[model samples]
Target: MTWITEFAPTTEGLNACIDCGLCLPTCPTYRLTGDESASPRGRIAAMRAVDRGLMPVDDRFAGVMDLCLQCLACETACPSLVPFGKLMEGARAEIAAHRPDTATIGKRVLFGRLVGFRPALVFLSWLLAIAQRLRLTDVLPSSAAKAAALRPVPIPVPSTAGHEWLPEGEQVGTVAFLSGCVMDQWYSDVHVAVIEVLRTAGYRVVAPPNQTCCGAMAAHEGAAYDAARMAERNVAAFAGHDLVFVDSAGCSAHMKDYDQWTEGGSDLAVRVVDATEFIAGLIAKGALPAAVETTEPIAIQDPCHLRHAQGIIEEPRAILRAAGLEPVEIDPTGMCCGAAGAYQLSHPDISDELGRMKASQIVATGLPRVASANPGCEMQLKTFLDDGVEVVHPVEVYWKAINTRPVRQAWRALKTVPRRN
Candidate 1:
């Protein structure tokens, strides 16, 4: 095998890299280290070297590759369509294949077991909640924490773990709502709001049975085999739906690239839609509920996956604008919030710097509420230390506010619909 094939590289994957370096200004690690090795192109070159046997998959290779936040910023900036996200994921898979057991017992906490099971997620949520209730966070020493920003945002066990689904009257189409691995524990309400917003737009929303984490986590961690199994499960489970609505941008973005995950590819690729895109689609069709009257400013942070992976730039803003709120854009140009999966835990220093910068931008907007699509962003942004700034999902932004009567009224209609759909 040649350079391209050594690390399980594909001709298509390598061909995708045009080396324009549009990703340079946007890469957080590159911005920090000012090293080519930290840039996406530099890392790609290293992967190529490892593939070609010009370089060993030694500590140096791992050191350079591991520096990436893998924020997908490059994907948005790339003119070559490099699929840098998958490239990094593949590189990690290469690393993990040759790497040692790095997962701590707590960190590993039944990841395989929780992959497909909701009960495990619920249990973890309760555990996190218990840790919170016991003030265990305060007891955690400095050694246990890297910085205030890198600290884990434990998932709360909500008063209602999840609300019972009620579709509003007649449905427009069928959709399967994916309960993600972490979101089920942290921002499950955003998903609940997704269902509410969808039903409001006249869709029959269903949480697909036995759905698991979209294998994005495993794929990025180099477990493509496990990732494929998760994707296959979702493909089969959501087979007959008119659409599959994934609330988390990260999961939706990865699933959209299902072709890359499977050697044989999946047919369910086209039906998957991100929540923002779907809601925006409803707005386009004039099925969107009336916008709410708001007297507040909403600071918006674009998730890299939503913006770059899916080419989704406007739907979320359309939802916010139609809802009568001012959408204040965070003007970092092309920065990621550094919550690219578990990057915060893996590289705390860089993650903290990015998170603080992002939070400061949100705070400068002087908005009491901040909204984004991905749950990882939600958890990461929840640590924003500004006085009185509450971060929320855009769906939650509308559903929780009383001023959005049409939106809420749409939810009212959902309560009256038949549930067995």
Candidate 2:
């Protein structure tokens, strides 16, 4: 029977699944639950059933879709190259459109509207900062509370103005940097580190003032229309630049597929590169110095988006090695830390379980520091791990080791420089 639903999972995508169950072993949920339904293969079967009208897009279907972390671990594991992530997102889009309960509507508004909207996001950051200072975050839901605990001090709106970093020597090229929604307000220091790394590579970095979020959170949750709108806005924001560098793994992964969301998205999507990839490229070209004797052993926690979605397995390690630091590889294949873009809030038990497991693995290495690419993964590592263990973006570690002065001092010195238009 032909599928009549407007946003039905693509038949070709569903057909690509060979059902070999290769994804079963890699799936975090399946590993946790030992249930087929939690596996990617099982989820694909459910999508097929819905497409054939054999199953309704009811609460069960919603549960199946929502329970997924969308880490794309299955996509990496699938030998058939089945676009399981896209199919699951398609099914979720249908569910979101047809079923509009109060909870669903509230989440749709929150993720779709407020989260990516810069002004709203900044305002919420301020509110969260206040909540955190007052110790009122305990009243918040689990995931939010955890996020608040990990959040760096909020930078006010005035300080949110964009900056352009001019390369000191002969410029390699010009690129636009995406200072992401929550990232800018909460983790501003990381953005600073990203700019410093770019500067060190001799690349002029322009951070457009009016940029919005990359909309990965929206797309993952099936808010297709909002995600598309966000993609269009970002494409327009960084239109003139040849390269657009994103430091956030989730944001970079989502922006790389911006073409799928909007009409002119390819213009931006094609230019998008992950910060680690860009820095690694610089190191390979000898544009940046190598290996500055870090005495401590560092552990690299591969963010799922970087490792699975973007296929960036080696660049970070290469960067670590270049910085004169030894990277400890975690066991069990660097599985998801359950910070899959708010998955911790939605499925606290599984999220916490995965997080604890990851923390255990990191601790086993006996490393004082853990390096990760994504802000969420870093936050999760920080929240779940031992207090003595410090979690940071890999670039931050590299930046600290490479720069002569302290990172904070270098960041402050950079901030004093005016944006070079």
Candidate 3:
């Protein structure tokens, strides 16, 4: 079989790479392997080879493509402004169409079928939480154990569908929130904080019930048809809202490109805003109060989706500062933590190497806590970082800073913390 006629990547994006090698240092896979085939240019070269009918879309070709984290840092570094992310996604789509392997089939099942249903996802999360609590994951196979270990412990209850929170004071218009599938089930606390923070800033927040997964995981896995269907569903769900706020960086990034996936999605795409960006704007406008009391320093680990994909570098820091926290820069280069959606599960070895690199950088800063926006990054950091090191969403830290009483904070500080493992 050859490249899927309809799903093949556009030659324009494939030919945009000029072999400048600027993307090499920024690519996680290339940096780890020092292999030209792993570099962005090398991958594009392979894509071109296949596009020209010089190579076959076989296991070897799929292996090279699968190795990428899809972090899109190379896009930021490329002088030619190559759309590496889109091109890579297209290549993967072609592979998925022509290959149809067991793993590909499983990815389609999980991302396409399972993620869209909140009840099933929550039920599975509950079971996984129980398994983690019981330490049953340790007894599972190596790969299964690793996947289970990433599940959030003490999983918060899923956010209510179609829930709406009114502003604390004067009304300042309404906005919709994306309670993502995995995020709503596992990290619902962050959504609570997001709502509280938004309300505190005088914006009514609503979690649209009709919204489903942002389809980022599906898109990254080459399930374009499923991804497009999910995008179309979200476009219809979020229509009429002037602004749709998303707390998950990965979701925010994907939603911003809805036009690429489906018709009528561009309107929704333009309305999507990263929560940090919106909150930062509020802070700049003095919509929220200044810090009541200063907190400890936090190292900011920028998710690749947030940093490279969305080009939101300083907004998170702005939010952190308004909460009276000093945000430390672990790496200005914005190296990926290797949690590019499901990349950690698919490429655990490379993911671990990158996670360890990020953890070491954070540890070197000697900060007690790390502030990360994306759920995947937070989990990856928690897995590799020292058990004592607290990993939290920046908004969670901000919420605690403004809401927690001094006595309660002191009491909480004195309580013994349990080991995550």
Candidate 4:
């Protein structure tokens, strides 16, 4: 229960921060509040204070850590290469163990217990959908109202049956697809789009059965052990595949670090690739079909995980451009849409501020359709943007343009894939 064994591993990362104040301009919270405690340097200072026994792991210490979006923008700007994201995760884990408040318990129950269970999220989405249909979402609490407002339309969970879709003559590679928890439930349309785009690119797809959540939500909420458990399951589930593709930016970014969780994690991590990154590679090699042209300007809202976490800033844009859609960039620094997986519920005020800021940036581009890679980001963007403006995944856009091939009856197994909820 002591601090050393609990939080010592992150001490090196904390000590590595140079406190140069270079990250201030990049930090969303620091920019909003102008408080040192909210910036990366300030949070690291608090971690160092607790590690040195100069400060206790009290509510005040937890407050500073909770305020962080974990966007990792500071890490991108840091000259010292400090592992701020990992350090913040470790600090949050310690806070979760030492300080269990109502909000903490709520997050643990929602993220730890419910998020990974596919059945629960499916049912919750169903109920939310019903609530929206009945015009009852407004009666919900503020946080629930925000989430409810995001997803006006809910899609049923898609079956994750093993699919081996091959091109008519050529087979580029056999890749496994990750049907993430929420991704499969709420945004199954995007999954369908991903499959079509991959198939069109000559890649044979293999979606493993019995896949679980990628644990990004749990990990971000300070449940590292639980996240590790999910990682081990995924590592074993996705074994033997030459490459594993994920459309969800957060899931891809988190899974790419599976090596830190258990044995053979790095093996799985290396094989993991974002769908945009993979399709963009196909475009680069001229293996995919001709670009499907469009004249409408498409505003690109880069997901923080895609841009900052994985350094995949251009692949989504590249894919959009190759599809003949005009790609408009907003916030080159990859500002977070504040949808850090249940962060809106945990930190409603800050989440709203960041979400509004992101929506405004997209609106300023004067585009009606905005392309993003993450479902959470899409939801966040939709929540704050005008009702007519569509927030869709870049893959969805790419799928629309190049998907001229008819659905082969054999590949239509997913159409009737059984639903549990």
The lDDT of model 1 is 0.70
Tens-place lDDT per residue, model 4, 52-169, is 8899889898888888898889888989999887787778777777777787777777777787777787788788777778888768776776655555545453456455566434
- Model 3 clash pairs are none
lDDT of 2 at 232: 87
Give each model a TM-score.
Answer: 0.86, 0.92, 0.92, 0.90
Candidate 1 structure, TM-score to reference: 0.86
Candidate 4, TM-score vs. the true structure?
0.90
Off by over 4 Å in 3: 138-156, 292-295, 404-421
The lDDT for every candidate, in the order shown, is 0.70, 0.82, 0.85, 0.79
Which segments of candidate 1 are over 4 A away from where they belong?
1-7, 103-113, 141-166, 263-265, 292-295, 401-421
Please provide, for model 3 over 219-325, each residue's C-alpha lDDT reduced to its tens digit, 9 standing for 90 to 100.
99998899999999999888889999999999999999998999899889999999999988987876665574556678899999999999999999988887899
Question: Which pairs in model 2 have colliding backbones?
Answer: 291-322
Task: Using lDDT, give the best candidate's number.
Answer: 3
lDDT of 1 by residue, 53-168 (tens): 78876678878878887777877788887867777777766665565465623223344345556776667667666766666755676323322322233544542222335556
Worst 10 residues of 3 by lDDT: 407-416
How displaced is residue 103 in candidate 1, in Å? 4.3
Q: In candidate 1, which residue pairs get closer than 3 Å at backbone N, Cα or C atoms, i.e. clash?
A: 93-222, 168-414, 172-202
Ranking by lDDT: 3, 2, 4, 1
Candidate 2 per-residue lDDT over residues 333-369, each given as its tens digit: 6589998886876798998899899999999998888
Error of 1 at 408 (Å): 5.8
